[model samples]
Target: MIAKLQIQLNTALYLRDPQSTDLGQKIVQEGIYMIDEIGFESFTFKKLSKRINSTEASIYRYFENKHRLLVYLIAWYWNYVEYKITFETHNISNAEEKLKIAIQLITSKLADDDNFPGISESVLQRIVISESDKTYLTKNVDQINREGLFKGYKSLCMTIASYMLEINPAFKFSRSLTSTCLEAAHQQIFFAEHLPRLTDIKKEEKMYDRNCEFLTSLIFSSLKS
Candidate 1:
């Protein structure tokens, strides 16, 4: 097997770097599996320790709290998505086409990435769709934002928003539309799956395609002069 990928994260997210040691790496690898299997709300250091055959204190040495660990995972995901978008769009010249491709990439079903062996991007995508909001919905979000824990997500939005501006210089809501499209892409799919009444997408249709279509329509419509 290929060596596991290591993407350096913000130091503030952890008390110790989890990528540096075997147990630390296991903390991250199993953390992703456990979080995906259960969820951030249901996940706990005590439970994680039991699953990993480690102590809660050991987990604490890597992360101060479960919330911080969730943020770390989400941030890693945002960075990975941004990298994929940038890589895919680097050679594409048309701004409108680029945005469409970006939307498709953002909304489409995620595949497991080989570059990052320990974490499953598909599961991470589901987590982002389902639980990413919890990362910043807390009272301490302002403090964490100041610490740059959310920079990866913000950077992704900013980059995509820039694409909108290039397509329509007169459009004033590029950033707003960018963020809305990104969030709505996942949220609408979530709604379609469990709360079908909340979405216009029918249950019978290919859900990912419809979500992508909706976002593509929304973004282009908002950008057209």
Candidate 2:
């Protein structure tokens, strides 16, 4: 049997823990679907409340505003990914193979897992790829960063960077390389679907496989250089 997983996020990201209560869980579960369906800009408390048959005030009880909620969602995604990376690489003794697994996890397609009942990873991944950048691009980013809101993302990068350093002890830009590849993976995926001209991935080909191949090549080449 697949074990259920809980992704603990920073407290500052939300007013109340959305995973704590039934109503709160509904907020997160429905919020993910609503944001993915209508997008973050069009997403509002009124819409979310109506979808969940709750009041806007009730939704606000769990989250400060839509932006905070978005950050919470993004942060949750990073934490989940980090957990996967840790679990998938825990037994591997080979550094190169471990790094390869991390790359594939980052670049591959996401699907709904029964282990996480309320959250749809496949749908959340779409929000992550498309709307995640909006969370930290605001002017108050420094304030939120001070609150440890970006810890999950930073932790994920650090985990991947560790693998890089394991493979090449002398590599100087492990963190930089990890962050760049992470962003590049998201950008390439977005470009392939929306701005095809911006990426080399063909529409007819398997996107995840092609993307994983490209990233593995890039990471190994850079580490070897």
Candidate 3:
């Protein structure tokens, strides 16, 4: 069932902009593939263009530079996750259920067979860990609270935090904890992939499920505490 859903999701994403198809999406996808195969430092637009059957000029038409393209790809993943969660669990009444559903959605998407096949574990780690720094340096801001990718992430965190507050008004932590939970999950997933020897579990699905369980437990425990 999960495999089938993943296939459908990938097909839908590929078919999203049939009319006036922007060649940029192909460039971005190839760039992501190159980053997955080689580290970001080793990745170049020339290599990406060669892989995508396009010229450097065509790639630049979509992105100013490789850095901006990376940021956009990361933002794209975040937006995709947000859209899936909003669609799947938006109407659930119980905050606890909503939280669980959110975790499940994330894990399922990450573990999906049709997920961005070229993205490597290290690239994902870099994106999650360096999101704040990247955004700050790129935008020359102290923090990201307004618009764009960071704002989208912030909105998701606040939405989850609000649901948590509804479940337990006494829960004192700010919405930042939601962000922390997200980071923790990303770290766990990365660790499971890149450092499996250090981890007891070997299976990606097990690691994903464990992380989801831990995150859900943390939220619910905090509510009770």
Kindly list the per-residue Cα lDDT of model 3 for residues 1-225, writing each as its tens digit: 223122111111222321123575467555656776686678788988888787988777666667656555555556556776787776788877887787776554253224444334345544554342354465534332232435556666787778788888877884866877866666666667776675543555477678777787777877788
Candidate 3, number of clashes:
0
Per-residue C-alpha lDDT of model 1 across residues 1-225, encoded as one tens digit per residue: 777666767888889998778898889888888988998879999999999999999999999999998999999988888888988999999988888888989888899988787788888888888888899899988999999999888899999998998988888988888888878978898898789889998765488999888988888888875
Cα RMSD (Å) per model? Answer: 1.6, 1.1, 6.1
Number of the candidate with higher lDDT, 1 or 3: 1
- Model 2: per-residue Cα lDDT over 17-51, one tens digit each: 98999999999999999999999999999999999
Once model 3 is optimally superposed onto the true structure by TM-score, how far is the C-alpha of residue 135 displaced, in angstroms?
5.6
Candidate numbers sorted by TM-score from highest down: 2, 1, 3
Best by TM-score, which number? 2
Give the Cα lDDT of each candidate.
0.87, 0.91, 0.60
Comparison by lDDT, 1 against 2, better one: 2
Where does model 3 exceed 4 Å of error?
1-22, 109-147, 195-205
Count steric clashes of candidate 1: 0
What's the TM for model 1?
0.94
Clashing pairs in 1: none
Winner on TM-score (2 vs 3): 2
What TM-score number comes out for model 2? 0.97
